[model samples]
Target: MTGPSIVVAGGGSAGHIEPALAFADAVRRLRPDARVTALGTERGLDTTLIPARGYPLELIPPVPLPRKPSGDLLRLPGRVRGAVARVREVLSGVDADAVVGFGGYVALPAYLGARGRVPVVVHEANARAGLANKVGARFAEAVAVAVAGSGLPGEQVVGMPLRRSITGLDRVALRAEARAFFRLPPRGPVLLVFGGSQGARTLNTAVAEALPGLVRAGVAVLHAHGRGGQAAPPAPGYVPLPYIERMDLAYAAADAVLGRCGMTTVAEVTAVGLPAVYVPLPHGNGEQALNAAPVVAAGGGVLVEDAELTGERALAELLPLLTDPRRLAAMGAAARASGHADADERLARLVLDIVYRHNLESARGAVGSDDRATEVLRPDPRVWRQQ
Candidate 1:
């Protein structure tokens, strides 16, 4: 028999969608014939991401909800009904033996609409459990988490799945390739700055304020100011891109990273073995800082609180490392050591195990209804072995 088909439903941003793609790729690696579909709203990054990855894409209607019992609460029931309908419609054509939700607004309806006989798994990518993942977790056969602190049931610490391009980068080749890609100086330290996708205004402001001194110290900088951030005019030693297209090259080129502590960013940095100065988003319950704590605790990076990330303090934290080559190398090695390279493979197997088990249970249930209660269907051993 052919390998079971699976659906990955999540998006809205690259952080959630990219990891889903990584898991899908991992599944393809193990079961070449397995069919994988990505279901997300057409409005999200999925429109570009799914097609670019050459996966079947399905779009569903958006469900708007309230944060604090606003007037939108009155329309809650109708919105949910519409969302469920949209999810069912999107899922109807595909024979998904399993469904995996990487937490986002899109995940909630995907899980609710697909949950029953088909096994479902939810992967929460934040330190704090997101609402979509939290709701999906209750019905999920298993839950995967990027951070250990995510408070969700059936939680397994899988780390974040990184793309093969980034994960497979060879260190020696990366060093040379990265330098060529960024056009950096032969042997000077390079600082990479980013703030997830939307760009942290606070982080950008601080980096811009501190740039002159960093330049004076002979440190090269490759900055991703974000799509909507302060546009500082170009300087001799600094290169600012609104967005970075080639992350592997950027990671390879950096001696150190200074950025927000989104779970995805932290995982990518750890995977690449690049040390960072993390400035976690101050609002939203400090989840970003919580995500970065493990790396900081492991001595792989430094965490700078948003309130404390002034120009002088940022300089103070970054300057010593730029000047000390040995310390930077040690930090980079430590960061890489903290990453889990096998995360995508293990997560893919776990998802399949749940699906196979659910299928067997369903088969047995059908047998009982047909007055063959004593008979039970056993899945082929190959499924278990593959899982």
Candidate 2:
């Protein structure tokens, strides 16, 4: 209670965990003394990721929302109570000054627990808001989004919070080295392909079928086919990776990218100023398409439906763009123009501001006076770059 203790709540998929970790990273930088604990559930990847990031992990019961009317819906009330109560215990144990949440199942409980006790800050990383985020926004003291039109409560679009490796990547200077790391030639346009830990079947199949032709067209490739994906003999000018630990190097080696249009992907691609061909997941609420809308509108990237991303289509749509220097440069510039490379720091400042302000008011016996006039401070830019 004496020092600011921040809790970042986002669990399950990499989409949720990555941003939470990114925010935690920035918090550690800006508030070195602040204790940052990751709020997660035993059901999610946080069991491994949180501790791996050097943050204490606290598990809570998950209350996943049913998509339709069902028996699960009937149990919603009881589940919410259990989850919120556990979150309350976690908050109290950590002396939480604020709950900074990237919306997911865990975020809802974190929001409910922090309602009157500590200020809640919600961050929506997609163009369309999810159920937990929508609910969290109603009570959040501050709201941040990756892009406009999130349909969440806030107009503060700070873009996605990303690690400094991406924000500070000097692609031009690292190109030769990145190429060398991938065992690629220093010249020719490179297409860096990745589709997450579980390979996107569409990307894997299409790229494989198009590989020989892509090489014939004078394009080199560094493709991560996900762990346990299919394998084959290494072709000339093509490098296949089972996993990519150094994305900074990958981005440096890429002239253009081929991947799905998720918020994290879009943010990282744009933050590093690379042209991408986004293939949105055909299912879900179509938020994937919306996530890529701004970049497509800016002529920074191309959006293709997953069902339509065949080998021929990829060649027709991607070949010219990847090969053309002028077009690639312009698209990269446009992508960078739409990026918020400093979002991690910006949101960290916002979180610390809300926490410190609330603490000051409590000290002055002015708790809950609705005074959020805290000025956001920026850390020296050199600090992040040096890191």
Candidate 3:
């Protein structure tokens, strides 16, 4: 009488939540009858994002895996045991037919709870697999990755699951409207800047330092300085926001991007075909730089280390590219070429395949016609260029 019950577990940061949301979006689009509930924790950004997107969010206590051994580490076993029990409750309540994870704090419990209970599908967005995903992949029915070599079993290279807005963007067609939305000139080059969801002080400082030079060159700037993190001085053709809700429009308005190399950011920027200057965070296990490597290798972007991305350095590097139309267009094309716009559909189909036992022919009939089948997973090759 009802479609399969699906639970997606990816909580904590935007990097984890956004991809999970995108995959949930795809699942709904492909199978409207299915019930998709996002498994999250109260402490995560999911509390805001999941509800806003109209998905049911089930919250649980966060079980943080402490890196260094300490009191928290001592309590790890009991904490994990309690968290896994809570996850089992959530999964049972939802009658989850399958567990799809994007790898975050909640994923560990989800993986443990769903063990031998329901089919598990793990999608890792980073070049390097995380501890949670590394565990989940042990028994995951299907393991997918944006970039290969994540060391997850049966890891197939299926790009990041991006929202339809980005996957379906027509930047050139909406450039004027997008620029107008930000109260900027419709014809000049615009550069979009942002760090991760929380904003980056390093980027804010660098972009602030480069603002005067950018303004003088008639370059418009739209900076999402992250919530509660802004120090950029006011200048002509410059706009700063606490956060960016309409990244689709932001991509349309910008000729190029200057931002962090988080997997979600890289996926969205490239999915929309925007040339970028990716500054990988200097911390962590060096996965951020790995996220940006392929694009840089394909000549679609420039990768800079966080320590080296000064305002003076930003101005010197970005100035020439913003001014050069042909080169920028070329870079955008290359970025698009390396990106997988159909990842959402492909992942959705994969989910259907395992959960519902959907075969190729039945899947096509359920998703599209014979004609549409040939091209359902192929992104339109048209590159969006700045007006």
Best by lDDT: 3
- Per-model TM-score, in order, reads 0.91, 0.91, 0.88
Question: Lowest lDDT 10-mer window, candidate 1?
Answer: 370-379
**Candidate 1 on 1-387: residue-level lDDT in tens?**
457689898778888798999999988887777789988886768899888998998877666545677878787667667877877766667778888999777787788888774778999888898778888899888989887978899689988888888778775677877877778775688999998666788788888888888989998888888888875556766878888889888988888999988888999899988899999888887799999988998889999888898878889999999889999989989998887766788789887777666655676687754223223433353544374
lDDT of each: 0.82, 0.86, 0.86
lDDT of 3 by residue, 206-311 (tens): 9889999999999989999988697598989899998988889999999999999888888888999999999998899999999999999999999989999998
Q: Tell me the spans in candidate 1 whose CA falls farther than 4 Å from its real position.
A: 89-92, 231-236, 361-380, 383-387
Tell me which residue pairs clash in candidate 1: none
TM-score of 2: 0.91
Q: Which is the winner by lDDT between candidate 2 and candidate 3?
A: 3
Judged by whole-model lDDT over C-alpha atoms, candidate 3 comes out at 0.86
lDDT of 2 by residue, 212-236 (tens): 7798989998888889676434788
Report the Cα lDDT for candidate 2. Answer: 0.86
